[model samples]
Target: MAEALNNLVQLMDPYLLQILVNIGIAIILALGLNIITGITGQLSLGHAAFMSVGAFASAIITIRFNIPFGLNLLLSGLMAAIVGAAIGFPILRLTGDYLAICTLGFAEIVKVVFLNMDITNKALGLTVPTPKSPIPMPIYVWLVAIIAIIFSSFMKDSRFGRALKAIRDDEIAAEAMGINITRYKIESFALGAFMAGVGGGLYAHFINYINPSDFGFLKSVDMLSMVVLGGLGSIAGTVVGASILAAAPEFLRFMSEYRMLVYGGLLVFLMVFRPNGLLGGVNFTDLVLRSLGRKPAIAEVREKQT
Candidate 1:
C-alpha cells in the first residue's frame, strides 16, 4: 500500500498534491482545537502559540543539532506539550472570555519571544530544509491527519472523553460526580497542545520556513473558526470545515479584496441561520433514525438512564 501510494503521489500534479497536503494539515489543526475547545469546552485563543512552540523547537533542532525529521517532530511536540502543561496549571482556572483574553495575550508573548530570540533567527525566520518537490511530506501529513481523526474518535468514546463531555455540559455537576475537573482540564489542554505542536512540526517541514508572525492570533482565530463552523463536537463536521476553509483562499484568489468580504459574509450568514454549525450535531445514528421516522435507541437509553 505504501509503495502504491508513493507511485500514485509521484504521478499527481504538484499543485493538486500540495493542496491535498494543506487540507490534511488543516484537518490536524482543526482536530487539535476541537479536542481543546470543542470537546473540553475551553475557549482558548492561544493555540497558535503552542504551534509556534513546536515549529520553533523543530526548526532549532533541525538547523542547529541536525536531528532527523521524525525525531525533531516528536521532540517539538514534547516541547509544546511541556509548555502546555506548564501554562494550563494556572490558566485552566479561568473560564469563557477571560480565558480567551489570557490566551490571546499568551500568543503575543510567544510571538515577541520568538521575534527577539537569536535561536529563531530573530524575526528573519528559520528556514526548514525540504525536497525540491513535495514528496514524502504529503504522505507524512495525511498519515498524521488520519491518526489524529482516529485518535479523536476513540477519545470521544473513552472514559476520559465522557468526563470531558460531562464537563462541557455541566462543570459543577461533573465535579459533583467526583470527576477531577482540574486534572482533566489541564490534561486536555496539554494533549490538545501536543497535537497542535505535532501539526506545527509538519507545517514547518512542508513549508520549509518558520516565522513567529505565522502563528499569531489570526492563525488561532482561523483554527477556532474551523472547529466552531464545523460543529463543536462533530469530528466529521471538522473534516468538512477544514477542507472548505483551507481551500477557500485559493478558490477565492480571483476576487482578491472581495474574497474576504465574501468569506466573512458567508460566515455571518451561517452563524445567523445555523448557529449550531454546519453539522453542528446530531450523531449519524440519530440522523439516520430520524430520517426513518424512528426514535433513536441511544436517546431512549439515555432517557431511561436519566
Candidate 2:
C-alpha cells in the first residue's frame, strides 16, 4: 500500500504535495482544538504546549530508542495526554477568561522549559529523523486525520458525548442532572491533547526538525482560528476551515510583503460577517443521520453566541 502511495506521490508537484501535507496537519490540529474548546466549551490557549511535548517526545524516541514511526506517534500522544490531564485537573475548574489566561501562561512556561532544556539543545533546536517509509508523510497524516474524524463522529453520538454537551450548554444544569463535570472536562482535555500530540509528531517528522519556538502562542491561535472559522462543534466545518486557512498563505505568497496583511484582513472580514463561523454548530454527524433516515440523538447546538 505504501509503495503504491509513494509511486503516486512521485508524479505530484512537490509544492502541491507540501500544501496537502500542511492541510492535513492543520485539520488534525483543528479537530483537536474543537474537541476541547468547541464541543466541551473549555477555552484552552496552550494547546500548542501539548504539540511541543509530542514533537520533542517523538523526536527523542526516534533518536534514543529508534522506535518505529507508528509506535512513536502513539507514545507521543500518550505523553501529551498525560501532561494535559495533569494540567487540566486543577485548571479545568476555571471558566471563560480565567481558563484562557491560565492555559496561555502554561504554554509560555512550556516554551521556556524547552528553551532551557538540555535534551532539546535549548535554543539550537533538535534535528528529527524523517521517517523513511514507502508511505508518503501526507498519506500518514491524512489517514490519522480521517481516523480522528471518525472517532469524533462516534463520540458525538455516544452517551459520554451527550454528557459533555450538557456541560457545555449549562454547567450548573448539567451538574444538577448528576453529570460528573470535572471528570468529563478532564477527559476532553486528555483526548484533545492526544490528537494535538499526534499532529505534532507528524509535523516534526515532516519538517525534519523540532524547535521550541515552532509550537508557540501564534500556532495555537492559528489552530483556534481554523476551528472558529469552520464553526465550533462542527467536524466537517473544521476540515473545510482548516484547509482554506492552511492553504491561503501559500496561495497568497505572490503578495510577499503584504501576505500577512492580506491574511489578517481576510480573517477580520470573515469574523465581522460570520462571527459564529462559516458552519457554526452545524454537525456533520447530524447531517449523516438525517440522510440515513434516522433521527439525530440530540438537537444540534445553535451557533448563536450573545
Candidate 3:
C-alpha cells in the first residue's frame, strides 16, 4: 500500500506536493496552538520551543536507537509533553502578558539549550534517518493531521473541553464552578505540546534535517498566526488558515524579496476587516451545511450563535 501510494504521489507536481505537505504539517502545529491559545485563551509565545524539542528528540531516537517510526513519533510527543508540564507548573500561575513572557522565556531557554548541546551536535543540527519504508510522506502527515482534527473536535465537545473553554472565558468563574484552573491549564499546555512534538517529529522526517535555528521566535509566530487567522476555538477555521498561510509563500514567490512584506500586509488587512478572525465565533459546519441546503441541529445552531 505504501509503495503504491508513493508511486501515485510521484506523478503529481512536486511543488504542489510540497505545498500540500507543508499544509498538513502546519495544520498539526496550528491545531496544537489552537488548543492552548485559541481554546484555552492562554497567550503562549514559545510553542516552537516544543516543536524543537520534539524534532531533536525524535531525530536522536531514530539515529541512535533505530526505533520503529511509529514509536519514534510517540516518544517524541511524550518528551515534549513532559517538558511542557514541567514548565507549565511553575508558570501557569501567571496570567495574561506575564504568562506570555514566561512562555517566551522558556522558548528561548530551549533554543539556547539545543544550540549549545553536544549531543545535538551544537549549532550544526541533527540529520534524521530516512525511512526505509515506502510510505508517502504526505500520507503520514495528512493521516496524523486528520487524527489531530478528530481529536480536537472530540475535545471541544467533551467535558474536558468545556472546562478548558470555561477557563478561557473566565478563570475565576470557572474556578467557582469547581474546575481546577491550574491543573486544566497545565493539561492544555501538555496536550498542545504533545501535538507540536508529533508535528516536529513528522517535520524532521520530511525535511531529513533540523537545526535549532529552524525552531525560533519566527516559527512560533507563524503557528500563532495560523490559529488567529483561522479563528480561535474553531477547528475548521484552523484548517483553512493553515492551508492559506502555508501556501501563501509559494504563491507569493513571484514577488521575490517583497513577498514577506506582502504577507505581513495581508495579515494586517485581514485583522482590520475581521478582528475576530475569518471564522471567529462562526459555525463553519453550519455554513457548509447551509450551503448544501441541509439543516444543522437546533441545539448546535443555538450554541454557535452564542
Q: Candidate 2 local accuracy as lDDT? A: 0.91
Instruction: Put down candidate 3 lDDT per residue, 1-306, tens digits, no spaces.
Output: 777898889899988888999999999999999999999999999999999999999999888886678888999999999999999999999999999999999999999999999999999998887855557778889999999988987787679999999999999999999999999999999999999999999999999999998999989999999999988888888888999999999999999899999999999999899888888886555566789888866657788999
Least lDDT summed over 10 consecutive residues: which range in candidate 2? 297-306
In terms of TM-score, how similar is model 1 to the real structure? 0.90
| Model 2 lDDT, residue 123, Cα | 98
Clashing pairs in 1: none
Alpha-carbon local distance difference test for all models: 0.87, 0.91, 0.91
Global CA lDDT of candidate 1, please?
A: 0.87
Candidate 3 lDDT score at position 90: 94
Which residue pairs collide in model 2, if any?
Answer: none
Q: Name the regions of candidate 2 deviating beyond 4 angstroms.
A: 289-306
Off by over 4 Å in 1: 1-4, 131-135, 284-306
Per-residue C-alpha lDDT of model 1 across residues 2-71, encoded as one tens digit per residue: 6777798899999888889999999998888888898999999999999999988877777777656777
Question: Considering lDDT, where higher is better, how would the candidates rank from best to worst?
Answer: 3, 2, 1
